[model samples]
Target: MPLCSGYMAPEYAMDGLFSTKSDVFSFGVLVLEIVSGKKNRGFYNSDHELNLLGYAWKLWREGKGTELLDKSMGDVCSVHEVLRCLHVGLLCVQERGEDRPTMTSVVLMLSSESASLPQPKLPGFCMGWNPNETDSSSSKHDESFTVNQVTVTMLNAR
Candidate 1:
């Protein structure tokens, strides 16, 4: 019953840069949610304040990718297939649009057992994006962003 607005691609939510690439990011988030049985938004993890993508990426980097899966589905699906989907999901959420796979490529990767896949880099919005986090470069950043609202625009000229 909740909207997972956090799954919106960073490049889109921050700057309104909608494209096929943005769709790919959203798809990745959905895949992660499905496999992990976690809401992309309104997720809570005491280990970190990161969103689903951020936490999933962390788990992947730690070589604990299987831990990100939903335990309920353990008996129903192949772990290899699940891991492949996780890999593809991470690939789709890469920070740069050009690095993301086209839908056709993603489909092939998902369906083929022999497909050669590349390791995925960090996801967009990789950090927790905590405003309370203090940085030494505070003077170089904007401090006016409120808790529930970000005055983002298509230009994103801030």
Candidate 2:
């Protein structure tokens, strides 16, 4: 999934940032993308920078989570189950790691019809700026700084 490739890359591990919670976030993103048939990254509109997660959040908050479902899957899926999945997915992607549910909790919420789920907090990195706009001078400088830091750290560890 994109999360494994994006957030959980080995480079992130170098910073000791890898955690089960991060995996939960990735899984949540995957679930939303799968249900919506859209990519979470680079999802945009003229009105908002929201990825699929943001869209889902807005729908959920508006009591319209069902609206986020893929139209192709109409009547083939249970509305309650779909909503529950969306809720769990949102919980997994909350900005605060501590606010995110564990993968075990996610599995339970997905599998059990009777489980009570807490409301999900806001998701992380929901900014709408085009991620590929590395053309800006400031972005170039940031990239160089990151690359240099990685190089120096690696050399020092070796």
TM-score of each: 0.76, 0.72
* lDDT at residue 105 of model 1 (Cα atoms): 92
Give the runs in model 1 whose Cα sits over 4 Å from its true position. Answer: 1-5, 129-158
lDDT of 1 at 82: 86
Spell out the clash pairs found in candidate 2: 49-128
Model 1 lDDT vs. the true structure? 0.81
Model 2, 13-116: lDDT tens digits are 33557777878878888888777777776675456456577778888899999988889998999998888888888888787677888888888899999989
Q: Alpha carbon lDDT of residue 152, candidate 2?
A: 41
Instruction: For model 1, give the RMSD to the true fold.
Output: 8.3
